[model samples]
Target: AQSVSQHNHHVILSEAASLELGCNYSYGGTVNLFWYVQYPGQHLQLLLKYFSGDPLVKGIKGFEAEFIKSKFSFNLRKPSVQWSDTAEYFCAVTAVSASKIIFGSGTRLSIRP
Candidate 1:
């Protein structure tokens, strides 16, 4: 079984500020990591994902994440954030061949204009 952990529960940033959210997973074998964002009153949406090929994966809305196998981490990053970026971020992990996904508690991002 694989599990994910998000280091920060809440984050606050000003517009155009750089953002990074820590996400760590516990899985020895092949696994997939994903970052999902949920806006106010909206459903969860995929931000980025890491399955294979590249360790650094780019996603929608200028979001990206780097998968560091050695560190068991897949941290999300954005060079600049906007006020509209305010949302809840969730980190998830699953075995390559597994059907069940384990999600982190989630991190709430509050962006100031």
Candidate 2:
């Protein structure tokens, strides 16, 4: 079984500040990593994904993540953040042969204006 761990449960930052969220997963075989975000009232949206090719993948809204297979980590980062960026972020993993996705505990990001 695969599981995700989000190191941070809550994060606070001022507008224009940088952000980084740590994520680690447990899986021995091939897997896919993802970052999803949910606004206050919006549905969960896919922020980024790593299927193949480059380990460093760029996502929407200036977000990027690096998939480190050796460390089993897929950390998310943003150079600068806005107040509107406040949301709950989740890191998920699904094995290549599995259909279910295991999600992290989730990190709540609060950006002050």
Candidate 3:
């Protein structure tokens, strides 16, 4: 079974606060991981990715994630989030043979100004 899950269906935060969203995947083999963000009134963008190498990968907009192989998890985090950071976050994974991606349900982050 290969699947991705996001624990937080929705999240709310005040401006300038730390943010963390949990993601878990069910897969037994090597895979590619990614985090995509969709900001309010904006298009979807790639936040980061983990194809290989370091487990701790950085992405755009001051966001980062650590891939834990043992736990089958890739959680997104930010030190301090702004109201502008408000968006819907998705965790995704893919196999070498699979051309398409497997996406988590999603996490909605609403940062209050």
Per residue, candidate 2 scores C-alpha lDDT tens digits across 45-96 of 9999999999999999999999998999999999999999999999999999
On residues 34-57, what C-alpha lDDT tens digit does candidate 1 reach at each position?
999999999999998889999999
**Position 11, candidate 3: lDDT:** 96
Separate clash counts for every candidate = 0, 0, 0
- How does candidate 2 score on lDDT? 0.97
Q: Which is better, 2 or 3, measured by TM-score? A: 2
Instruction: Give the residue spans of candidate 1 off by over 4 A.
Output: none
The lowest-lDDT stretch of 10 consecutive residues in candidate 3 is: 95-104
RMSD values, in order shown: 0.7, 0.6, 0.9
Model 1 C-alpha lDDT versus the unseen true structure: 0.95
Relative to the true structure, candidate 1 reaches a TM of 0.98
- Candidate 3 Cα outliers beyond 4 Å, as residue runs: none
Model 2 — TM-score against the truth?
Answer: 0.98
